[model samples]
Target: MNQVIRNTALSAAISLSLLGTARADDAKDIDTVVVTANRSAVPADEVLASVTVIERSDIEASQAPDLLSLLARQAGMDLVRTGGPGQTNTLFLRGGIASHTLVLIDGIRVNSANQGNFDFAHLPLSQIERIEIVRGPRAALWGSDAIGGVIHIFTRDPSAGYIEARAGSYGLGGLNAGFGTAHVAIGAGFETQRGFSATNPAAGPGSYDPDNDGYTNRNLSLRVHGDVGTQHVALTGLITDADVEFDIGETAAINRELGIVLWGEINDRWSHSITLGHNSEDLNTPDFDSHFGSERSTLDWVNTFTLNADNTLNLGANWAHETGFSESSTEVSFDEGRRNLAVFASWRGHFGTQTFELSARRDDNSQFDGATTGNAAWGLDVNDSLRVRASWGQGFRAPNFNELYYPGFFGFFAGNPDLRPERSISQEIGVDWLATLSQRVSVSLYRTRVRDLIAFTSPTFGAENVNRAAIDGAELDYHFEHGAFRLDGNATWQDARNALTDLPLLRRPDRKLSLSGSYRFSNDAALGLDASAYSSRPDIGGDLPGYARFDLRGSLPLTAGWTLEARIENVFDREYQLLEGYNTPGRSGVVNLRWNGK
Candidate 1:
């Protein structure tokens, strides 16, 4: 679209605006702060990578059932789940595989080395303060599993006494409470829902189970921090337990994690931050009497030196050790572990009309040889209203324990202990615009090629580096806000195909679009609408048809410091399948009441 026409559309859309209400350009959000961009607070307009932030207010306004559902509607993201909350959920960012995107909680890595993925289904939004998602490869600064993007989750901290209670469709109810002071804070919540059936009636050949696949989840979190003379310290913890029934049987899953940090400005020119964290998960299937568990401990230290007014340098080192074990009634218990150490450096320089960045990292693994990755980027400020950037990066993903060391005695399935890590090269170009004081737009194009992709061998059914792929995509994001209304939307078109077969990668839609709008009746009340469309794509056994879904939400002030909120999801009752044999919810509703004490 022409610049004039696009600007006109942005201006026109605001008059037309849903509870999706904007803060009117002058209120609480005139300046957006993000941390995932450079490990420091940077304005979203100044970031080079595609970024999205979902704040606590956004979550409370939308009333999304879970974290996964909200993320599925975000730009450059695709999600597949077998059932409702507590199901096995997989997320793909910009056509990257499930393992390509790195996930962190309060600066601690959360992906499991056994499954090569994080359990988004079990992550409750009530416990999250804010979420920052950065799109594009970041391996140069973050190391492995960042070939696609990075998602950072910050747990909430309470400033005053607060509480909430709610109930929803299909046996949903929960309670949340928090209390805190200037130097000490704590927040905790608990919620549960009985979900819909998980399986399709007419599944493949003989894989059919007709029953409601209900689920139960419980979660708790705490955050506390204090400061001493010239130093600061903090500790954070989270635990979630779930019981879910799938097509075959019931499984219990538990995740527990803790993070600690101590850091401060050593001197005027130098600052340092140090972090230590531990994460563990335990899963059990009672029917088959199977168990899979993993534990990981990590430490990181970083120092920043100010070279001059326009130049800065950062040096960091990280160490991590992970262990995994699996046991079943029929098979003997097996345990495997690996350790790695990494060092990285990044330089940022600002000159007239231009900003430059360069970063490199090296990791030495106990199970394999050392690997090195690097990235370079340049940003040109065309004027006060526009900025353009280009970047190139290299990344890699280590094989998970299930892929390399899971001992399967059965003739049909086995592991390949010698499998190698998948590696990739990526490039992208983008332009950001601030056409008006309250309107913004961005366009980005990117391509990534991955070699040494791991797959199961045809006959032995063991993991091997037998496949390669190339993915190319373009994205557009727009945000506009005027009096009494707000509009946010994004669209993506991608071609993710097998390098040799040329077939579309499984479950990656070719096109996806989302739009949300909110209209405020007053300062404390609003009505919002959301819409999502996904193009047809390949699945495990066949192709799934394309579909669109709509949701309605509203918020109203009930009393002092209390609000009443409600939402109806799948308003049209569209029938869709994100996975081959999975069923999605149809026309569900939820209501919540909350109190914010300051």
Candidate 2:
């Protein structure tokens, strides 16, 4: 813990020193537009919720290896990886459980119905254009599984063509290429690595493994959009397949998504959109002879009416069908299906400097009772430089197939036929200050109470609704850009505990801090530093230790359209563990060469 604190302080000092020596330049004003904060496009600065927008430029500049690595820098997020690449990745948002957050790709839900969580390990950075993270409860507009918040990933769009190849430590190598015309684009990527042992030998005799674990992935995506008369239409498809080797078993997974969207203006005051989508996953464990498959098909139609310059009305209806299936060599099996129909509405009113938003949703499920959620928020812009916002919302997470229908094996493990969804109510207040054109700051405070949490307990060792949680949290985010240097940082403090036991939630650190800074050179080259620290937290195995890590990145332009990028991760050779029994990556470097068609 002392070492962790020292490292964090050193990182802060480095960032501050860089800022002091940075060249003075006029920072450009970028007005980020986002849709996840609301169902419609809105300026990020005007949104009432805590939101983070990560663009393609930022993604490339950071040189992060995967989606999980990039998301770990954000506030209010706790990431736990069981091992190296291709391992089990779990994210707890706003101190909520791993399954409480909703994940979407192009507005289509992708979480598995069996486990109720989406794996971020296989989502490559090469195919993603941007990511929008909204913190706090969003179920009022998005429905179940949004008790924590929402992460919406937008795939790459048609733009300049590019191709790249990379090689890193631990026998890591990959290729990524993309090409696009005015209305169509395609992207493909392949990655393979001989990773270190996933489980540490010190954990236990049963978990000891000296051999290396290997991983391989192949992914492809296609996107097309065009204007047909007065309406715009888009079609998107993505597929990914991955194979992973563990100590005693091997697993393979295939994931797919398809979407068709159409939208257009009906008049000066009204516009509408229709989206049809499908997401599915098929996973197999060869050594265990186990298989799990899940799929979700959805339809959504939304209409927006501009009542006036200061007011708007949004109405939408959604329908979805989900199914899950699983089988194991132990003669255990699970098969279940469910359907949901939902209707939602929201009203936004801007009165002078104060803005008001109210949204509600009702989800009627085939297997359980209906769930209704709502959100009310108000924001006030004070003299154009300061803003204050407050909001209250209700959210829920439905029971997954494994918790409700899994068949007992060897008279040991069982499932409860009767289970209720977990529910939560949350409230938050925030303040944003644009101290200057080159500096901005945001602070937020929140509290949440959750009830009817599912847990496996004594008696039958089956799932039951017997737990509750109380979470209180705070966040501070800062951004500064002066001339050729830029800095961004955030700090999070959360107390997430079980109400009955007063125990800390698993793998949720009580404190987290991150800092990222970059300096641009006169020759068009750039150097960046990324550092983070996390406090110790309890895991299933035991109390994991606190740690800190740093990464160095740089890029240089070469001939014509070619460029070279490189990153040295774990610059200090800091040893850390996100999970109690899993080993983490050590000092490693990756070099990438790319040719752009711009």
Candidate 3:
């Protein structure tokens, strides 16, 4: 076991740029373009990575209240939260820690540099156009924070005007509208929910409390684009303000994001895209009298050169600046800042039935020395219906602000100035089988090793990089669409162990399975059901029992250009806990009315 762990660690740092054999292809063949898979648009069928695309139609059909609820059903994905809706949430993908995943909104990074994670609870689905998730390491192309995967969100570009309103149990309600022309569009929405007690643990004299934890939010989004001469220019904006009541405190928060993109063809073989973006988040908790804030700005320029019909090359450079501050009390406050610059190059080519991609990157950080990493991936199309892919990649994560500079303001926890960045190597192989015109199946097996994992020591001490983990897992997913019936399902099993103590990782389940199916009627109506089951998972000092939950949804046409939709969550009313002391929602539901003006 010791040797196995050591070998895995070595695999992660291997210098690799093995340009494999195969011809290159674009998204034209599959009609589905995935950018996160390679930092450029590539057909999903030709990419050597595992990917999942959720389009606008899928979101509306799923009736998912938030991003977390929709993503939890995907294979190789898991969520750990402290309470019900509007609470703190963390995502673990492909057995990697929360910080290992990178999130992007319209090609701009959105995770907080100080905290190394994103808040998935508050992102309004009404503003989203699509989501493309590329699973596995791609730091070689994306630069840092890609040990597990990347999720890229595209905001809606609505050209057709529409209005929607929803209301249901727990005081759930919301309204959204979008107006647009051929080259410009604007959207806005507001939502609120009378939540349940975030936590139900027994209380003893200020130790714990149980009360209704409610949440409310308002948001606005806009998109504009037009052609100037031979070039294209676009702008986007998203802003959200929310007030939430947790188990113990009340918080008012606001988030803002803005970006611009420029695209054009310099010549017949060369095309370029430049993006500039900014994101900011501020929050204040009245009960606790605390405040936290973060801001990040980014600039990127990418040039794509079509070497030939069967070959392509991509060159890109990026700059990012981040600043943040946090204060739990007047006596405890800290502010931090950092910046990074990076350049990368990639080549995609193929030989007959096999395809290959080679990528490399160099990143320089203000707080740390420069680092260079690269990877190589290969793919084989055995026939018209089968494809096989395998890849090895390297990734790293810089220490977050709390890990490097926090002064232990709250108490019993301090930062280590000398902490080093965590590093990882990931490997995976998968098979995609198009069994029929209406059905498909995919299976992937992967192993990842993360070193220099930072762990916080107890008893009034500081953090240290004294932990390592070896994560091995398998995922199986299937989808079928025939006539008016659509069914999709996936199952996952993992063995995540601490390399030093040889114990299972905390709060990560060993087995999970989920399935969703829907049927459409002739009257332009539909009905869908979703169910999930999980095995027991380990907690800080104990284990959380396994449980299952079910949900149902339906839609119906009301009148010309009008529709009605409804859903029931937790149909079985199962009582379960994602965290030791938190509470999960019981039976709940919502109904919506919408109108489309074409």
Q: Estimate the Cα RMSD of every predicted model relative to the unseen true structure.
A: 7.2, 8.5, 7.3
List the pairs of residues colliding in candidate 2: 25-483
Q: In candidate 1, what are the lDDT values of residues 27-104, reduced to their tens digit?
A: 223236555666543457766788888877787776787899888888899999877778888899989988999998
Error of 1 at 555 (Å): 0.5
* Number of the top lDDT candidate: 2
Q: What range of 10 consecutive residues in model 3 has the weakest lDDT sum?
A: 12-21
lDDT by residue for model 2 (1-598), tens:
1233222111111110011110112111122555676776566787899999898778888889889999988999989987889988899899998889999888888888999999999889988877889998889888999988999887765357888899999899999898878677788999999988998876688666878888999999887776679666778888999998887788999999998877666777777778889999999997878998999999988787878778878898999999998987665497789999999998988899999999999999998897999999999999789999999999999998888888766655577868988999999999999888789999999999999999988877788999999999999999999999999999999999999999988889999999999999998899999999999999886888999999999999998888899999999999888877788999999999987776
Pairs of colliding residues, candidate 3: 22-350, 22-351, 22-354, 23-350, 23-351
Candidate 3 on 391-487: residue-level lDDT in tens?
8888898888878878874676888878888888888899999888788899999999999898897666688888899999999989999999999
Candidate 2 TM-score, C-alpha based: 0.94
Clashing pairs in 1: 18-517, 18-518, 18-519, 18-527, 18-528, 19-527, 19-528, 20-518
**Candidate 1 ranges with C-alpha deviation above 4 Å:** 1-31, 329-331
